[model samples]
Target: MSVLRINVILFGIGNIGSALINQVLESQQFFREKRNIDLRFPIITNSTLAFFEKEGVKNAWEANFDQLAIPFTIEGIIEFAQNKGLENVIAVDATASSELVKHYIPLIQNGFNIVAVNQNANVLHIDFYKEIRRNLKKFDKTFLYETNIEAGIPVLKLISDLYYSGEKITKIRGVFSDSLSYVFNRFSSEDVPFSKILNDAEKRGLLKKDFRDELSGVEVAKKLLVLARELGKNTEFLDIKISSLFYDDLEGTNLKSKFYFDADILDKYLEIAKITQVKNEVLRYVGEISIADEKLEVKLISEPITSAIGQLKGSETVFEIYTESHGNVPIIVHGDSSRKKTTTIARGILTDILKVAEKIKIKETVWL
Candidate 1:
């Protein structure tokens, strides 16, 4: 057996970050015994403060961070890693901050492979996207970010595999947003007011963005752009045409309020639901790109209730992939959309870490 040591510098101590720490602590032993993988977190950080764990995190990691974390800059992190002589370093980004993305290139240059749970880093300006890829190649470092879209559903990897195999992908479409999926899924089948379900999801910490923001379809569009770029499309973010679920007249009202009063918003969603119901269809916010037309779309469409996308429950997501080999039968993927999503998402991030570890072969052989 060979033992591999994986060191992770985790960013973002919010929901996903905290969950990842818990997962690492809980699974550290299993990986060591079963896989010969010694995974450790030597450093952890949020947006403003960082904690340097000399011996890796313990169960009391949260308490230690409260007592020992200090304000930090990217320069300080690089210096600390250098001074400690940490090897086989991987930086895991679990934050949604665009500013944090500015440091990705620097970290990669400083001998770090990146495992991102962040989407902005992939969907930013196309030039930056290309530049990051160039740097990764130049440094001979691996970058894995399966959780960037579909909450770790492996949809991006599927697309990449098909494209790399010389298969022509005709189109890819799905209900991409978990928050929006839950809201619309409920609205389509139940008689409850949309505002009630929206607020309830917020109370349960299910709404990652404000419910209204999910209605704008910007996040779903970003997912589409990332997938498009994966297909070697020279596409810009602005190139995708977005159709907001909310009408144009309501845009101003949404901007003025963090979560605008929504009794009326309920009416709009209900009206659309009624239209879909009459045709034996259900409302779904879908993102689709037809490569033949060279255009991307994010909009609301009516799907047959018996269809794969329509059968979604809670925040579950599905993808319908169309490729030249499959003809009319598209590959359908179901997301790991458990209501307790932090655990599943953290596991996804951990899977990416193992990918980097296995790829770089930072291992020592031993006879057992």
Candidate 2:
């Protein structure tokens, strides 16, 4: 029997990666039999090294790590992918690093499809985003990052599909940052120290140690930029007005720092919400895009709310998309909602892509 094959390159092997790898292995037969697709994770990488197997990586690639060896580096990964004649390759950036973004431009330009869980690349300078998009257009490759904002949420896919289907979106808003939502909701009732909460969360693997990306609202802003781009608007990161709750000194620092929020700030906000009789009110960091009379407004809304934002449990994300056709669509997508979730999302996106490709191929063959 002839086998259908799809090549996969993975950039991280942490918790999410492990979960994803397990899922892929468990679902391998289902994919082949049900979807008529055979997916293979040929390359697994980390910051320092990578493991490549042309015969297809075993599900236990990391086991007995001493004997099975491969040098891990960005250059090595790129070289291996090119050498393997791996067309329609799926690059999973589970590393959550901005450095991987540069590799994407070249990969996309070379006809590689990428499914990333990394939000850093999308949040970078507008020029970088544009360059990647241009390369994607030039090579006709797919760059799927639906996991960036909300894992397994289909947020980006929904937005892109709606826009392409001629549906007009008037506003975009939701609980964008799981970390911030977690922290705020946890401390809404008490005068807990921000530093302590960050430490506890990180130690528990609930939040990234580098909390700036989540606290500075840059992550939320980046997701908004992606949505805007999908909506046919030319937007940059700076275009979004983020009302960051943390001070500038907190920027780029790990969560282990001794930074604490002003008790007064927390107290005042809490008191106001209480006096206003808002039940379950908690501070939620939001980025919004609204269109009124053909004029678009893109800004961040830092408000105390009683909705999903304030009520987000654990690391789940709930977002709402309002369109002319769909009206109000509420999407609730959950995962580890940590670094682990990001990696899983990347894997899920890759699996989804292979399934989609299989369907397309089947349709084309039938038509022919």
Candidate 3:
């Protein structure tokens, strides 16, 4: 049997990273036997500690890494991969650190195909984002980041696929954030205080610990910006007008804890919720981009229960893509409200990895 070997250099050994490493180890043999691909994790790391084994680490790498891994730098990792002379080298990033994203261009230039869940790189300055794409083409390397948005719902891939398939995309809209979805869904359906629901979400890890990270609407805005660029719209972060879920009346009283001191902010949400209730609708944090109108906005709006977005339950995310061929009934991709799970995100990263592997074919045929 011939072995098609591929080396993996993974960064970020947090929940998502650890899950990916585990999945790789568990499925290594299956992939080898079924697909003729030998996946190797030569380097696995977090921000400070890392474990390096050229033959791939043992199945129980976590216990061993704690004792064995030494201090290493990104430069060292790059040098090691280069010296190995492997044909397929994939760098998988699960970290949110922008510092690591700074090395993406260089990594691609060094013949390392990248698969990342980090959104920072994809939503970088328009110029830099374009530059990275240019490098990937120039070096004949691949950069797949289908997990960058909405926990690997393949939303970005859906856009690109339709765009390249001769479909004229006119509008893209969706409920984009899990945290926001959970917060608003519960707040709308239940009579619980908005502050209580917000607190519950934060404690349950549904919302960012800082709270404003989701309440400020920046996350949804960033996601919209990423999609806008993909749709060939010339726009930047500032170009999108955002409607914050938090009220402006409480601008200075530490909004993170405002729910405790300022109950009036909750009143604002209640007023909107009651109004929507009378209208027989649900509140959803929605992001929209209209190519024809040249508009991009992220806001907390109410949609009728009959609508695809309004019928969403729990933390589910729904994307409605309007293309010329699809007409008024847009193509929808739905996430099962469980995108925050580490395993799901890791699975998305693995999907991208295999996509890169498919490019490696029989360079030379040999008879046994």
Candidate 4:
């Protein structure tokens, strides 16, 4: 029996990170017995502090908080991993920090595989993306980020598989925000205030306090950037225009004002519905990149029921990928409509990584 163990370094021990740790611990036995793979959570770190154990990390490390002592800096993490003489190290970033990208290149150069759940790194400047790719090529390591986009949706794999099979994607469009979807879906039914729905969502842990990223369409823009990159199109987040539903002054408002304010763009849509004769005037933030003329459009769509985006429900993200051979086909990916769903997507990425790792013969690619 081969007792092979893979050491994993996890960053950001927040809600998403905690869920991922739990899933890893729960599946350890099954993974070891079935796949001959023993996963070890040796180094766990956050922005403030870190904890290291050669033996597997405790599942409830976060609950204890102070007892587990380790260094916190980026250098500290790298030094600890190196000193341990860890053969196989994987860095999982769930923080959504752009700074994490700066750390990944060196880690990969040292032959550590990086799997980032932080979409910021992948979605930002094309130069950064090219640099990361260059580093991956130099070190002969894998850089997989399946969880950066849709949670628990194998959207990346689906696109890659199709592309590899010689399918040409002509146009891509989607409804890609759980928070916005939840807000709009509720707005359509109850005639409730947009701010009220947002407040409710925040209290329920469905939306963040400052949900500008999700509501402003920046989150969806990142997803589209990743998709465009994979399809051999060099694109950046700024290159794609985003239609924001959030008010510029939203950051200044207190929780009390959020319920009373009519600053949100969705509020205008609702007001229009009340006064105008427009039926089923639903609001959806959409991102599209068409290959025909290489045109990219990102805007909030408010149209009739028969329109492509007039029927979005709570936290359900629908994607349409138009290819030369497949034509227009819709792929619907749904989630829990909460922060917890982000963790689910993180877990899904881990699952996909494991599957990919299992397929690569160590003997053939001794460098990996």
TM-score of each: 0.92, 0.79, 0.92, 0.87
Descending-TM-score candidate ranking: 3, 1, 4, 2
User: Scored by CA lDDT, what does every candidate get?
Assistant: 0.84, 0.66, 0.82, 0.72
- Please name the candidate that would achieve the greatest lDDT relative to the true structure: 1
lDDT of 1 by residue, 117-208 (tens): 89888888888999999999998788888888865578888899999999999999989888888888888878877767777778878775
State each candidate's clash count. 0, 2, 0, 0
* Cα shift from native, residue 312, model 3 (Å): 0.7
lDDT per residue as tens, model 4, 39-79 = 77777778777777746544466643467755577777778
TM-score, candidate 4, is 0.87
lDDT comparing candidate 3 with the true structure? 0.82
Encode model 2's per-residue lDDT on 1-368: one tens digit a residue: 34567777877887767667777888889988887677787777777676677454344667623346566666666777788777547777777776777788877766567777777767677777778888877876767777776675567777777788887887777767666667655656566655566667888766776666666666677778777777877777767777665544444444334344443453454446444644445655566777554233323333445555555666566666676665665443333454565455646666556744664466457866
Deviating ranges (above 4 Å) for candidate 4: 54-60, 63-65, 246-266, 273-281, 303-309, 329-343, 359-368
The number of clashing residue pairs in model 2 is 2
Give the winner by lDDT: 2 or 3. Answer: 3
Q: What is the lDDT of residue 272 in candidate 1?
A: 61
Off by over 4 Å in 1: 55-59, 253-262, 269-273, 276-278, 362-368
Clashing pairs in 2: 49-72, 50-72
Rank the candidate models, highest lDDT first: 1, 3, 4, 2
lDDT string for model 3 (321-344, tens) is 998777899998887665457888
Kindly report which residue stretches of model 2 are placed more than 4 angstroms away from their true locations once superposed: 54-59, 64-66, 72-79, 189-200, 247-256, 260-282, 293-314, 324-347, 359-368
Tell me the deviation in Å of residue 336 in model 2: 9.6
